[model samples]
Target: MSHDALFQLGMDLEAHPAPRAERAAGPRSTTQTEDTIVAPVPARDADDRLDHFIEKQGIRCAGAHLIIDLYEAERLDDLPYIEETLKTCVEEAGATLLHIHLHPFEPTGVSGVAVLAESHISVHTWPEAGYAAFDVFMCGDAKPEKCVDVLERAFRPSRTAVSELLRGREVA
Candidate 1:
């Protein structure tokens, strides 16, 4: 999408009505003056505005980055397997894969990156620790969360934690 469209979306989202509570409260504190009167504080609706903005934007929303931490993983030592799994994950997520690079450690472990049109997915594994860390970042219509299922299936981790962050959120 063009920057102008994005800017318009932000503007549309910002045009929310002020809360009734704030409007009813009016001025909480005022200074008494003979010739000068203090101005009332403006209603603070930053949190409400942000919530409304995100809601209105919907799927046309900002990019998403999924940070995954896996423990007791089964295939941290297999570089080739990891490379293929990541490719499949990217495909399943409806993202276009541009390129992929995989690296193997001296004796064990693997690291790989799969570049995509929307963004990228990267993995760093520690075979000795049975752990792996993955970053899946995608913008536009791509669904980064879909990759989590692929990761869980391929790695067979005993425990997993995932965090989803909205990247490049515009609030102007």
Candidate 2:
């Protein structure tokens, strides 16, 4: 699929929202800047927010999705080391982990997920190529960006790249 199919979500960037929620008092008013629109939601009781969507960069959405790549990396095929590194990433990201499951592939590659309360961190490795790809998606207060640093440090990659997507951005 093309970049537009992946990120744009059929939203016309220049269009303004037509309907408004019950307005907020004080400084919690809505505003628009550039391509993003910011709107304040009415306060809800703590028990009502079970899914943990968050407000980021003025847009309310599900979470941050980080696409991470590691090149010229080390320890790509080590199962135990991969598990440890993922645990470290979850800790460093401040995400609550529920479980970790990893599988080692033929000849020597690894794939796994660190399931978290907010979301998950998944990895797929190509040991022969000294490359690894990771996806870290989490909601709430979990610092998904921190995982990029942890992965780089743990793998000692000569080259690293990351991209972020605001998941559920169309929910407005």
Candidate 3:
């Protein structure tokens, strides 16, 4: 569930989820003095914060996003197996999982997402083609690279293709 949804249900997940903050169009705080107005300064410090962006390879970014493609994969239509794999990925990546939601398409195929405190892991599968696509994105100290190995073991993909992108790469 989303942060607001969690609150509505009387559960507080976190003080501020970084993923939503980066993309939210919410109310802004401003201070008006006798002559001019002072714009709000965002909270960027890491004090008392559990998850935040980090510097990787001399480039500062919010997180790493990995595009993993599995070919000749097995059990692309099994929802339970897929869910377990996602959970395992989250655990292996050292990311905190918040919620999991999956959908099974008609005929054959399963798509799912595992929401994490660091970020998220999503999957799209094609059983007929023996293929699956997975996206593992996380920030802070979480290691998204670990998911590739876990996925290979779970799906038993004969061949895999992987690509990486640094999310929220700020301009210098």
Candidate 4:
């Protein structure tokens, strides 16, 4: 490998591991139950250009998908608002909502996941801690930032980190 190639390889090895949920945890809400539905948001072809952006960003993966995960949420009552916020974002971007789930908590907010054909969006909130956790995965013409706006409006998290993953990798 050339010097630049070797340097690039070294950088990849140093990146931190990504977060993933092993299983859904936390208290379940009774007011609103877990729901799964399919609502595809329509988008213009211009949105299909995400593949080029991903390559330009130097991401190493097989397909185009952006996953956004949020942690340390402090509210659950904000679930409705969060959902509306996300829907607004998805609609604005012309994507679809394949499925959506919202569970209301005891004194605070809600925990749920909006499954999109493009990918999915999830959230967990803790009012006592004044924090919340969220995830968004957008593929193809899907726009993930729209969901993020809803999350920010509901949780107002002080800190957040984003991870971009390339799906459909074939290992031989």
- Using lDDT as the measure, which candidate wins? 3
RMSD of each: 19.9, 15.8, 13.7, 13.5
Query: Between candidates 3 and 4, which one is better according to lDDT?
Result: 3
List residue ranges in candidate 3 displaced over 4 A: 1-46
lDDT of 4 by residue, 1-172 (tens): 4433434443331233222331134222223234556655555486554332333245433334445544554344666676776677667655667677777778766677777655666777667776666666565556566656666665666766666555654322
Clashes of each: 0, 0, 0, 21
* lDDT, candidate 3, 1-172, per-residue tens: 5655654654434444536664376522221122221223244556633357789888898889999999999999999899888888988998887777777889999977787778889999999999999999999899999999999999999999999999889745
Q: Residue 52 in candidate 3 has what lDDT? A: 79
Question: What lDDT would each prediction earn against the true structure?
Answer: 0.72, 0.79, 0.81, 0.56
lDDT of 4: 0.56
TM-score of each: 0.64, 0.71, 0.72, 0.56
| Candidate 3 steric clashes | 0
Q: Give Cα distance to truth, residue 160, candidate 4, Å.
A: 2.4
What's the ranking of the predictions by lDDT, best on top? 3, 2, 1, 4
Q: Who is ahead in lDDT, 2 or 3?
A: 3
Write candidate 1's Cα lDDT for 28-49 as tens digits: 3222222221223334465532
Question: What's the distance in Å from true for residue 38, model 1?
Answer: 65
TM-score of 4: 0.56
